[model samples]
Target: MTIVVAYADTPPGHAAVTAAVAESRGGEAVVIVPAVRDERVPDVAELEGRWPELAGRVEVERGDLGDPSDTVIQVSQRLDARLVVLGLRARTPVGKLVFGSTAQRILLDATCPVLAVKPSVAGP
Candidate 1:
């Protein structure tokens, strides 16, 4: 089965792709680019360039500029993916309450198992 990845162009997004590559273990990765404020999405060329190891097997799907949580959940269910991989960053309790989290929604709603990972920190 293919592994579904929630991809973006930020640090967390890059981290998610890396984590997905490691988890795929030579399997295919269905990368979904959830819409951002700018409407910029990552094409195959970008994804391949950023992740050479997963070049051929990476399939990118662009979502509409809407609720990211909905896109992720829908795609995961439709693909019947083995797992849904996403990058997670730490957030304060107040921040979470103020602005609802897409990651939290995905974790609670995805049909397949969700794998949330944080980027590794560099030593000072």
Candidate 2:
């Protein structure tokens, strides 16, 4: 079984990756799908450089779909992934209503189980 990650370049995104690694049972492929718009997707080498434990086990999948939510769902369904992980950032109710929530869409649409994580808050 494989794990699918909705990746973005943010603290929440990093936390999701960390959570995915912890959830892995060794030898399960961790596939990353870029989950932010207008952001460059990190190369596999860059990902490995950031997370040494992901070396030789991480794969980036840029799905053909346009929307980030659609891409994540499409890739997860295509891979028949065992799990889909994504990070959630706090959003105001107005923001959610106006911009809509990619995380919410993924949670509702994904064929496999979705794990939503938030970044750890720093202590004062």
Off by over 4 Å in 2: none
lDDT of 1 by residue, 42-122 (tens): 787877887788777888665553787778777777778899988888899999999988889889988888899888889
Off by over 4 Å in 1: 35-39
Model 1 scores worst on lDDT over the 10 consecutive residues at 30-39
lDDT of each: 0.77, 0.93
lDDT of 2 at 42: 88
Residue-wise C-alpha lDDT for candidate 2, range 13-93, written one tens digit per residue: 999999999898888889999898766878999998988888999999998888999999999999899999999999999
Task: For residue 67, give model 1's deviation from the true position in Å.
Answer: 0.9
Worst 10 residues of 2 by lDDT: 33-42
